[model samples]
Target: MDTQLLLLLLLAMVLMASVAQRFPENSCAQYFQYVQSGIGSFQGELTLGLQNGRNRIDVRFSQLGAHDQSVVGALLPYPDEVTVRASLRAAKFRVSLWADASAVLPKLTRLVYNNNELCRASEYNPQSFFNRFFELHINGPQSPHRVAPTPVIHKFPEGQTDVQIKTVVFDGSERSISHILSDFVNEQTATSAADWAPKSPAITSISSSAVPRQRWPTSSVPTISSIAPAPWKPATPASPFIPNGIRASPPSSVPWPSFVCGQEGTGVPYIQRGMEFPRGRYPWLTAVYHKESFSLAFKCGGSLVSTSLVITAAHCVYKIREDRVLVALGRYDLDNYSEDGAEMRDARRIVMHPEYSSRLQLQPDADIALITLDSPVIFNDIISPICLWETAETETEAEIGSIAGWGTDENGNSMTRYPRVVDAKIATVGECARRWKVQKILDRTLCAGNLDGSGPCLGDSGGGLMIKRNNRWLLRGVVSLGERSTVDHCNNNQYVLYCDLAKHMTWIRQYIS
Candidate 1:
């Protein structure tokens, strides 16, 4: 042979060796062709190499219809073997191609190449061959292409799909393909792949092999549709009788002054002595009277301090005939009057503290009254005894004290008799004096009630102004006058003055006996 011929032969042998080396020791590359002789027909499957590498295969398809045909495709990667399948069905003809797994080259170990040149064939093209062979879709059919509908993405692990592929290499190296299809599905579903073909509609068959089924209702039942009922509304609260602005005052700013006597020509001395009751020991105490007939009556609460001495407010004794006064002691409920209930006593003489004035009745001295009962009250739970005054040189106003009367709560709303007695801290003399503009808080009287409007009102007068000393309840003062003005001139101030017991301990003792 000539030298040139020998060189050409050597070159060809080298090329063959290189190609053989590229494939798995025994794998071979294959080509496939599919012809869709009609419109709206397609089928295909792909296999991936276990190892990471490129794969090449040849594919062909035919378009025999007047309108453009669609083809669905899928790629599945595997570890041991790779399979490629494609089918095309037309009205007149059908074509199918399947690449055996064992015979095909491992997808991970092959090199792929494409033919850039374009050609038109009868009912088929070379581009399909390349795409199907390599398990990839090549760019073609730009116009008149059908786009696949987007897929809906769901929260994963719940709606995840798994795809796996396997291939067997001649060298016995196994490879696998596994991935969560959800992410890819989600991305493809979200993005519009311009080159993708629309999915084929699912195929169904009605053949003789089908069994007969029982007839059932196909029409949906008409629903008597109803809506949820509207939400319930809340009832309104009761409006208070006192003015909203008046009730808004702080409980500590009320202008309550000390009740004073003897300076005003009232035969009553500045101080009087009486039996002193210790705290928590007033179990002998009783209610001398409680108002029941008058719903709006101001004499709702008072006590019998002595047998003849019926202690009450001058105002409560105001505007009423002395005959109307009926004292009920030892009673829990005013509406229920029985001998076994609160002891009932009649009033013969009602002598309000002479100095007790009502000019504004704003002064504390004018707030007190001494009503002399026709007969002495017998002590019982319904008519228990309350300890009276103890004469002292002077009683400090800051002494921790309590006022027990049938007064209203912070809102001036009356409470039931069972829990009528309300107690609050006494304001300092300086604070009370400053707020009320009283020059001298008499030695006979001490001041109580919050500077606010929280002191005695209409009914609380003449009630015992008891003090708690060493856990004993003492009558320190009388619940005399709260803010006297009906208009609440001292707005926002809740002060109340009491007839100081220390000044009257002597008189109270003599008169009660």
Candidate 2:
């Protein structure tokens, strides 16, 4: 009740508030106590420290009333992390020390937070069930990065045993504690099914390791059982139907388009029962024609990427005479040459990816090509270039990439009148590799299709594999190859390969603005 005592209490409260407001100039730490209740009770503790962008983590886990244990302690670089990979057996685990953590933290933070209570439980709120013991906020403004809703991590099973993960932190204000906790939740609760899925190296360390799995040593430093795999590099693919012959071209030159690319186009609304894309639906779709004696035949598909540039599969033009090729932009119906929005351009030059080869069967290696139009094509509502995909991250899991072209349809018949457009589910890198038995599929090729006979067919070569984002269509891949049917047409039962455009950005930018 004395004045001195009241003043001392007020000062103490203010000091506590300041500590919660911000960390010291370059040092901070946090601790967490993880407890899981039920059948097999579990308890653990984690400590995290950050100083000068570097991270130090120490974790100890024990099954309640039992001696079974697991511990991970490591000092990681700014963008590195410690990952724990366990198989069916709880003890059969691979603890990778200092794997690349860059992919795991920043990306998850940028995702749009959906109203998922379980995932929200992974947040770093002090009052939450996960229990955040302490946190030190950075004094500066919060990060402004935002992204679309990312996949949410599911919660642990209820009842007998609850897995509680406790983590401590130090100087991790730049990288918030919430992001770190979310990453841990994802790693800890991953299902066996996800083990086969293609995930970023930071999340799943499924690579050839020099070290073998073994018992952990009774020491402060966690033993490293594996070295992180090098980053996944994009590979490429090529068309299969084009005949081999020398393609010729004159000294090529053309002006670039002045307007923006990848603008939305107006056409008939999507009809679930129909596969035929209406006129003006895809302004960038170009029918590549092979000039025959006094006539032209639709040979392949192409995409208008710029006023002067068209992208297609390398095998479509490789070794084929460029002079005999004609590119018709804004064309929809293959049978009618004088459709309202059709315009044909001469091929001034043809350039295949330097690494592309026609001899490589079932391999889509460097399968992209660029064609130089003789002159700049004027843009209209029905004739515009599509934007190239520029996202650094790979396509999201189960995302759909659309294919539209004059490929053959069901019943083994050619689409002689109009191009067909279909949405195909993009397959993961591991799925692609396993289906085709080609490890090189990881780098430059993307695999996508439906086993329900719904995908690109014969003559769909060189067509664009497009994905829409922000109301604009982005070119993600070029149709390359797939299995052949017993009748020598496309095998719709398998996934098809396309040349991943992201891998060839450096080469593409040299030719584009």
lDDT of each: 0.34, 0.49
- lDDT, candidate 1, residue 272? 11
Superposed by TM-score, candidate 2 places the C-alpha of residue 240 at a distance from the truth, in angstroms, of: 30
lDDT of 1 by residue, 311-354 (tens): 65566666556667766554444344442323455666665555
Model 2 regions lying over 4 Å from their true place = 1-258, 267-274, 392-396, 438-442
Candidate 1 — which residues are off by over 4 angstroms?
A: 1-300, 338-340, 411-417, 437-444, 450-455, 484-493, 506-512
Best by lDDT: 2
For all candidates, the clash counts are 72, 43
